[model samples]
Target chain A: MRALSRETTALTLLLAPVTLFLAIFFLIPLGIMAVYSLLEPGLYGGVEWSFYHWNYGRILGWADGFIEEFDIVYLQVLGRSMGLAALTVISTLLICFPVAFWISRLPAKQKNFFIFLITLPFFTSMIVRLYAWVLILRDSGFANQLLEWLGLISEPLDLMFTGTAVIIGMVYIFIPFMFLPIYSSIEKLDMSLVQASQDLGASPFTTFRRIVLPSVMPGVIAGCILVFIPSLGNFVVPDLLGGARVVMIGNLVEQQFLYARNWPFGAALSMVIIAVMMLLMAVYLFRVVKADSNR
Target chain B: MNRSLGKTLLTGYGWLFFLFLYAPVALIVIYSFNANPINVMTWKGFTWDWYVGLFGGATTVSESSLYVDSTDQLLDALLTSLKVAFSATVIATVMGTCAALAMARYRFRFKGFYQALLFVPMVMPDIVLGIALLIFFVGAGISLGSTSIVIGHCTFLTSYVFIVVSARLAGMNPLVEAASADLGANEWVTFRRITLPLILPGVIGGALLSFIISMDDLVITYFISGVDSTTLPVYILSMIRRGIKPEINAIATLMLLFSIAIAAAGIYFKSRNTAQ
Candidate 1:
């Protein structure tokens, strides 16, 4: 009985601090934000204590037409954000899948070295990486200078402040996030299965479709989730590279808090983002559970 | 012949991929030394004026006027970043290590729930967490400043430390603890003498990672930081928004070196632990 009591005491001592800290800082803050989303915005900068559903109604097209009118811009921005994030996912998967395969086939020493090279950029400052893109894509930037020197064109291409620039920046910064998972999955791939498929007179495309794609689907899904979540909420890339042209949902949330001072409305926008994130996580979890059951 | 040709094509593509990853960074490093005052992209004679100007030293290039009003604000931001990173890292490492130990060694009813709960902060969208913390602080009457940033950081950083320490603890054998108990050592002694030394490398690694992440964190800090408590990354961000200057390249190069050095050290410790 004494020993059991002592063990329990130790466990309590170990668990208490994190539980308390997270409860006060993490869970309570989210709960309060959720509550604030349903509160009325004051005339100036603060929120009123009265209940208000118009904050979300403004986004979802239920505005009463007296005080708040439904603006389609918010929904458009949300859709654009999702669309850009999906494009980033597809681009990163295409860029990383072949490279992951190439790296997996390398000898052990070179493989580790290449993996180190891939992960090294992730440790660098994100702002610095984004700034590099600004230098490359600006009107008086490297790409324009190089093209002019090559006598290809007299005019500078409008690369910066475009959706293409934003996508490139997103893909550059998120390569490691996508690469590591795909590489791990590729490393575990069985070469003999590919050989057997080929021996059975399957075409190269057919073999890849039959054997390789199924094996790496989990990693692709994991990588997509990892890349898509951050891309969906990104403001910095669009701010620097997209300029004022491409506005994402994250920038909208920022404007609501910093410029508009509509705290309740900002809270509402955040709740929508949380909703999307939760939905994606639920889908991913369900797929994983199903995969495990099948196994 | 077809297979060999395919292999060669794959090898070339792989190298090009790496070049795409690194060339932009290389451009920044090289251009920081260029003496072009108006356009940073154009190549001019090499000079160390930008690097010299970053430290408040006088530069010979009169055309490249310094964009920063004063270097003191930059130094102040750096100091704030270090202070926040240090305090947050210490608190997070302790709490996370303790939590990892409890989860690994004990059979608790909410074990699965706690594990999932920890992942929520990590996977939550940064903007959502930022706004949530912003609302919470204002509503709770907690002022926005270094204290709030530290608290905000710990909410997520503790999860990172927990993961690293938990990985270390998972690879360890519990029989050693049992052996220590059999030899009449109390739990405290066993933990101090047996477990801590074994996990010291991981603890150090986790601390280093949290410190780097805390220093680099901008999104959450942007929403919660007080007017005077700007961090280094946030400072750089504001500078970029204002205008591009040669000094930014110098600062960025230095930051890149610092981050790489710390990450290399963390990887070294991790590799050494694995080798053992």
Candidate 2:
């Protein structure tokens, strides 16, 4: 009984610091945001005392039976956010899987080098890389110059500040993130099973579909989540590459709190995004746990 | 023959993927040497102009040149970034290691709850955390500056440190602890001598991870950083918005090389470990 009490004391004492730090700095701020979402906008900087659901109503376009009062602009923004995130997840998965599979197939001595190369770019500051892409994709940039030099086009292509540019940037930077997880999964796969399937007269495609894909599905799901969540909330690519032409959920939330001074609305939008993220986490954890149970 | 053909195709595909990956970073490194006083597209003859300009060396600027930062301001921003990163990493690594010990060594009630709470900071959107912290600080009447930046960073970084250290702890040999107890060492003494030493590598790895994350962080630092506390990324971000100069490219290349050297060392160690 005494030893158990001592253990509990040690645990409490040890856990206290992080718990307190997180509570004060992280949890309290989020708690404040939760409350702020319901409160009306302040005259200047803070939220007013009165309760208001108008902020969320405005975001979700809940018209109080008045058709003209409705605006689905932010909802569409939310849709765009989802669409872009899904696009990033799917494309990154498709591209990185082949890359991961290739790396996994390499001779054992060389495999680490290939994996390391994929992730090295992720260590560099993204702002610098994106700026470099601007140098490549801008008017009179490398792409345009090359095209013109090749006699493929008479004029410089206007590629910068386009949605395509944002997607391109997202895919490029997110490749390692998607690749590493998938690579780790495939690297650990029972290759003998793959060989067995091949030796049983199964076609390559049939072998891959039955053995390879199922074995690496965990990594694929993980890669998809890793890419999808950040892409959904990404403000940098859209802000820098998309310029003013495109706006995602992150950008809109930033605008509200900073420029528009609509704290409640911004808080509401964030809460919604946070809710969506929480739901995704729950789904992912549930799926992973179920997979673990089956195994 | 078919297997060899397949291997060749896979190697080609790997090269293509890598080319796509490294092109932008390589462009920055290459162009940093170009004496393109104007746009980077117009590649002037190779010169040490930009690197010299990044240092305190004198540069002859034409009338048409955009604004340039002196080494003083750029160094100030770099120092601030280093300071914030170091301070945040220390705090997160210390507190996180302690909490990780608790989780690893004891069976506590509401363990999952605390774990989830820590993870929320990691997975939550930076924008959400940025604005949320902004409003929180503003409401709390805490002035936005270096101190707030440290706290803001610690909030999210603690989670990462916790994850890294706890993973190490979970894999640790339990018999070592039993041996320490059998030897009649007190709890604190055993922890100091055995557990802490055992987890030191994890602590260092977590610290490095935290340091990089803190340095790379822009959005949270941007929202919270005051006029005097602008970090390197923030300064560079502002510069890019106005216009990027070749000197900025030089600085970026240097930063890239620094990180690349560190990554190379990490990869060497990682591969050695895997081989063992």
lDDT leader:
1
The ten-residue window of minimal lDDT in model 2 chain B covers B267-276
True-structure lDDT of candidate 2: 0.84
Give the TM-score of each candidate: 0.98, 0.95
Per-residue lDDT, model 1, residue B32, is 93
lDDT score at residue B55, model 2, on the 0-100 scale: 80
Identify the runs in model 2 with alpha carbons over 4 angstroms from their true place: A64-69, B63-66, B265-276
Relative to the real complex, the DockQ score for model 1 comes to 0.83
lDDT by residue (B1-276, candidate 2, tens digit) is 499898888889889888888887888888888877888767888878777777867666552453454678889889999999999999999998988888888887888898888777887888889988998899889998889999999998898889988888887898998899999998999999998877877787788778888988988998889778899899888888887677778888988987787676666544443353
Candidate 2: the clashing residue pairs are: none
lDDT per residue as tens, model 1, B31-142: 9998987798899889899888878898987743677778898899999999999999999999989999999999989999889878888888888889889888988899
Interface RMSD of 1: 0.9
Candidate 2 CAPRI category: medium
Q: Model 1, A59-78: lDDT tens per residue?
A: 99999888787899999999
Per-candidate count of clashing residue pairs (backbone under 3 Å): 0, 0
